[model samples]
Target chain A: MHIPDGYLDLSIAAVMWVLTALVIGLSLKKVAESKNLNVPLLGVISAAIFAAQMLNWPIPGGTSAHFVGGALAGILLGPYAGSIAMASVVAIQAFLYGDGGLIALGANLWNMAVVNVFVGWYIYRLLERYSKFGAAFVAGWLGITTAAIFVGIEAGLSASFRYPAFVAISAMGVWHGVLGLIEGFITAGIVSYIHSSRPDLEETSNAVISKVPVAFIGVMILLSPVFAYLAEIVGYSEPLENVAEEIGLAEKQSYTGIFPDYTIPGVNEYIGTLISGAVGVVIFLSLAFMRQHASAD
Target chain B: MHLLIEKTVKSATSYFQDFFIHEYSRKTYLHDVHPSIKLLGTLAFIILSISTFQVKKILLILASVYVLALNTGLDVGVLAKRSSLFAIFSFLIVLPVSVFERDVVYLITFPLRVFASISSLQLFILTTRFSEILYGLKKLRIPGMMIDIIWLTYRYTISMFRDLLSILVAREARRLKKTSHIETLKGGSKSLGLFLLRSFEKAEEIELAMNARGRKISYRGKYRAGFFYILYISGVATWWMML
Candidate 1:
């Protein structure tokens, strides 16, 4: 799960760094808002997680898998604190151990910390209402799966990387899905034990989201196709296409009609692109708006 | 299974201990270099190595890394052995590109890049003290709280590692039967849970002790790079630009 340097294009890595900085900044604020938060406790728990990762449990075939502990962190601390702890652990691994590359830290943190912590936290929060064991199990499973998906996308998006997008996705997905089940059972057992012994430590708070931000995200999604077309216009081909050409593979044309490069086929290229973008924006915004209204109700 | 656990514990403990000993025992020019300079040099080396795909440039960088490592009084054999797993993993990553794409340039460049980057990082870690690095980071103005967490984590990792070793030994000594895989997993989980519980308790004690002293964990050091470090850095930057 550790992406080494040169695994991603510099541009993509820069973008990930910017995104990571924003999330970490937000997490810092969130953690600070908690009056009872013990900063040193966060450090100690992170060290514990790092040490615990060294312990490998035997699987059926004689091979063993170490615990990731992201989900466990989220269960004990809320998402923001969990993200901070996981990010610290990851940073230590990179800077001290050289287990991961410095340049790729942002992308690695995005995959392993932000995605894993948030997905695990939210899913556990959502499902723990019904069954604690099931929540932990599914949160751990989905957390790793989602992280794997991002990893595949990041790797496959690099022209320097050899694997095709689908190949990378499928391979990462299948392998990590199995790994995730192991992770799931371990997380469930840990959480179950903690629930029995120290229920007081479990996080009870949920992250609050203002409607304005949700609406803003919806608008951004609606305009995404336009951004995509603009990106294409700037000679930025899809990562998959870039890699294909790099490897001497012939570019295959699937569809070049109204949605050629995600533009409206019948109109002028720019106009067609705008129309397609508009359509995508409307569809996404509508879905988001509906979800927001339903949840509010 | 017991042997595996014992080996894991031993290796992990030794790895940290080795790092600690090497930082204190080694005395060389590189060791005296400011932590910021070494850190910047490491980052520059990695960035420059990965910035190009030219075989000649990559090889030159690799040779330069080796020369630097030797100058730093590191044993090349030991460094290579320590980094062997990473080298093998790097080879595996680009193996598919070599076979499927048959891109000779990529095939040659990728592995070299990985090796050069890893070696550059190794050079930095081998010579610099962890405390010095943290102090440099503090001077760089990374968030204070984050640095606090990292410093605490580093301190506790050694202590908790000792705890982990003892736990593993205790488990191994108590076990008598040939347990099934499921049983082993259960036992592993229980031990891990107990280890974590102990760490939490120890953390509470540490927090109380710090509070009692009315002091926060502060990384205070007066280490600064000299003119020579700047000159060397400029030379590297110039070489990178020429590449």
Candidate 2:
């Protein structure tokens, strides 16, 4: 779920914008490395994901979802470019289709695209090294969850920073955490099928682990504050549209209390653990996975 | 010319913000507002519309629509017709919700939430121009690289879609006659898979061309900034928040 502009404070919104920009900048440098790098093809994937999003599959909770596009891009194009590609899709959706709001670009990009890019690719690379099937399955699985966690973080961050609202980070985290697993299965199945048909392509792929790591780390550092600023903006207040009355859009308000409504179970704790586990796995696997791949080769 | 402009503006006003139909291009009162503002407006409206089951707020939202119809010069008849597409889809999914729940309040609230989202979205699409909206974002200093990928991807999408269509056609022709529905289904899927593989190769070539043209991710603007001034006239925007 891409939140709109003015959902968050300007300060937060500004921070997100900075992070998204940094990711894009770094992607370009990486793209320049190989002349044979496929632009239109990745572009096609972006477009298809954009179009496909219009067709959502039904999930439980009376909700429907389409492709996330981030993991798909990561698996196909590698991580850095993958992040940029997914962000571009969000941009087009914002500007052209208005699916995602212009202001929430930072949050959406950071959550849906950036986090997925680094986490998905790194995880996929590691998993495949040990067992191709395992890697593909995990890549697809985490790909879906990465966005869920990111969205949860975003919703959590937004609630904490901007407004004390109906849904907290924990609520969103649990909600999307369950929601994303469905996507993970679909993503894994698709990746496994594709990789099986073209396993050689993965090994020969231009994206070696070492080169990508440096780029992502550098980019992440520079963009973190920028993303923080953008999130602050969207999470905070923004000018209202030409409505006769002001709508209930307060970017960030001081939290009044723990939260009420939604008598869901240890909902918050479960979400917290889920996010923590995902991060732990991503960090642990990226290092251990890369080493395993290197040794296997 | 004046009559046509009036009619077009009217058509625009009536449509629930049909994103990126920049037929009017340069100027109209609505043209100058920041995209972020319109986005926030819609978000606020949707949230507000959903949070209440009161007839009063629904009427307010409806009134907002009427005002939109007046300001944008869209015909009430045409706008209502377009509005129903979303209605049809919403009703498709929601019919069951209302069917099973039966409780008036429960049925009503969720449907209204859907309606509010659909209508507010239409309002956004009708009012904003994609390129100008993008210009506004660029001015806001969103990354140059993301913008570049979007621009290139957009330019290439139509062609790629067309290419897939042709390949599908040729593949079908080579197979002589139509097969069982299931057979065609399997064949069709495999062909599309290959198309994806080829497209990956296609991206590499485009990247090469991009590099050859001296395009870097952070390349200084090759496009004129004159247009940004048109959208960024709210010179005090940055400080507007600070104050």
Candidate 3:
């Protein structure tokens, strides 16, 4: 799951860096606001997580699975401190062990630390009201799965791997889902032990539902290209024509349109590209709006 | 099963022990260079390598790194071995790209860049002391609190690793039969939980000791950059610009 340097496109890597920096900065502020922030505690826990990762547990078929512990960290500490702890471990892994690439550190941190920790924390909080075991299991499972999805998307978008987006997603999803089930069991066992031995340590904070809207916006932005690609495949004739030609079918139309290859009829190529993009966005937004309204009703 | 557990514990302990021992014992030009300069230089080289898609530039950087590693009197074979797993993984990752890419140059470029980047980092870690690296980070104006945390973590990790090794050894010695996967999982989790509890307790003790001595956690060191440092930085910058 560690993205080595030169694997990601520079533009994608830069975007990840900016986003990770912002999240880390916010987490620093949040942790600083707490009066009794235990620096050594955080550090030792980070070290423990690092050390624990080396301890692989046996699975069936003579194989083993090592713990990533991102969700476990979030469950032990809150999201803010958990992110910091996981980040330190990740940074050390790169700097000390050369386990990950220096250039891709930000992307790795964002996916492994920020994404997993926050997702796990929120999910745990939401479900803990029902069952502690269920909460821990789901948090661990979904945290890893979500991170894997992002990794798949990153690799797919880079196009360096030549793996189609769906292929990457499905492959990573199935692999991590299996690992995640093991993670879920481990996380639940740990959480249960902690609950029984030191009940006071369990975090009791309510889930913050307000962040959902912001996450929705982020998802919408991320999926914009996918939406555009889908529109091109469905609404336009080029992809169909190409597929038809590949299968030895005759062309439906011999002539090109005014907007050839998604270009506007009378505009410059750049402007036509913009117009086509705007149209795609409008279609996606309208569909989203209708879905939201339908769900509300 | 018992042999597997013993081997795993021993290997983990040896890795921690061997790194510190090797770092402390090594003496070479790289060891003499200021940590901050070495850190910055390595980072610049890594970024420069990663930034380019040309196979020639990547090979140039890799050769330069090899020369630097040899100059440090470090075994290039050891460095290569240490970095080989990631290098192989990187090659495997870009293998599919090679088939899909129209240009043959891309096939060479991606894997070579990964090799260069990982080798450079491995060389840096091999030659640099962990404490010196922390000192360099402090001098670079990293936040005091974050640095302190990293420093503490580095300091405690050695002792915690020792404690963990002992705990594992004790558990392994007590085991009399081949264990099932569930049994191993249960035992591993128990040991991990106990290790974490002990670490937390030790942290509290260290905090109290620090308070009693009225001491603050800070990196104490002098950073001196010589002519070679400036030349190194300039050379890397010039190469990056040329690329």
Lowest summed lDDT across 10 adjacent residues in model 2 chain B is found at: B234-243
lDDT for A141 in candidate 1 is 89
Instruction: Give the interface RMSD values of the models in order.
Output: 18.5, 20.0, 19.2
| Predicted structure 3: lDDT | 0.69
lDDT of every model, 2 decimals: 0.69, 0.51, 0.69
* Tens-digit lDDT string for candidate 3 (A178-243): 989888777777777777776766532222324654364345435534543443334332232244
Over 4 Å off in model 1, which ranges?
Answer: A203-297, B1-4, B21-24, B165-177
Model 3: residue A182 alpha-carbon error in angstroms? 1.3
Chain A TM-score of each model, in the order shown?
0.71, 0.66, 0.70
Ranking by lDDT: 1, 3, 2
- Candidate 3, position B209, lDDT: 82
Put down candidate 2 lDDT per residue, A213-253, tens digits, no spaces.
55556467445644554554554432232121232121133
lDDT of 3 at A4: 78
User: Which tens-of-lDDT digit does each residue in B169-233 have in candidate 2?
Assistant: 56756776546433532454454446566666676677678778865543222232223222222
Every candidate's DockQ is 0.16, 0.13, 0.15
Candidate 3 residue A273 Cα shift, in angstroms, is: 45
Clashing pairs in 3: none
